[model samples]
Target: MNSATTTTTKSRALRRFALHATSTCATQAEAYGKCILATYTDVRKDACKEEFAKFGACLRESVRLPRK
Candidate 1:
């Protein structure tokens, strides 16, 4: 497989982990602030910036607190 394929797979895995993680958080706030987001942004590889954005989008879509 090519580098693009590898990066895409890894990004998908990151999103999957976020989904599973949110399902188990003590609170939506906890899920929203899951450490992986920060860690990924802080240490991201330049080549995978697009994939990181995809991961961020997945978190935004999957890990929100319910409206009051």
Candidate 2:
């Protein structure tokens, strides 16, 4: 491919990597949140559920961002 095409492909790849990294970081945060929630017996299950929901929402929102 030509230089212009290569550059565009590279840019897209970089953007994908950045988004993947952000999602991964968010996943790590959710894991840590679950650990904190696990410490409390009363709300442990609900806390874990909420953490998963929050992570899902983050991913969904990220997908919608570039559309607007």
Candidate 3:
């Protein structure tokens, strides 16, 4: 395949992975978003550390691509 075809295939794969991850991690993402929104006015460092950590972990697990 040419460079353009390869690039398009990779892009589509990334989009698919992103969509899957978003759906799989929706709960964790919502929690993190709520934490940020709740503290939006008075943001503090590490205020949402727990929520963010959970969200990150979910995304990491959800988006793992299998090796050929």
Best candidate according to lDDT: 3
Model 2: residues >4 Å from true position, as ranges?
1-28, 31-33, 36-47
Q: Measure candidate 3: CA RMSD.
A: 3.3
Tell me the lDDT of candidate 2: 0.64
lDDT of 3 by residue, 22-47 (tens): 78888988898899999999999999
Q: Can you write out model 1's per-residue Cα lDDT over 1-68, one digit (the tens) per residue?
A: 56998999889878766665556433543543454466655764454455445555655665565579
Error of 1 at 7 (Å): 0.5
- The order of the candidates by lDDT, greatest first, is 3, 2, 1
Q: Model 1 misses residue 68 by how many Å? A: 41
Which order, best to worst by TM-score? 3, 2, 1
Cα displacement (angstroms), candidate 1, residue 43, comes to 24
Identify the leading candidate in terms of TM-score: 3
Q: State residue 59's C-alpha deviation in candidate 3, in Å.
A: 0.9
Q: What are the models' TM-scores?
A: 0.33, 0.36, 0.70
> Model 1 reaches what TM-score against the true structure?
0.33
Structural RMSD, model 2: 7.4
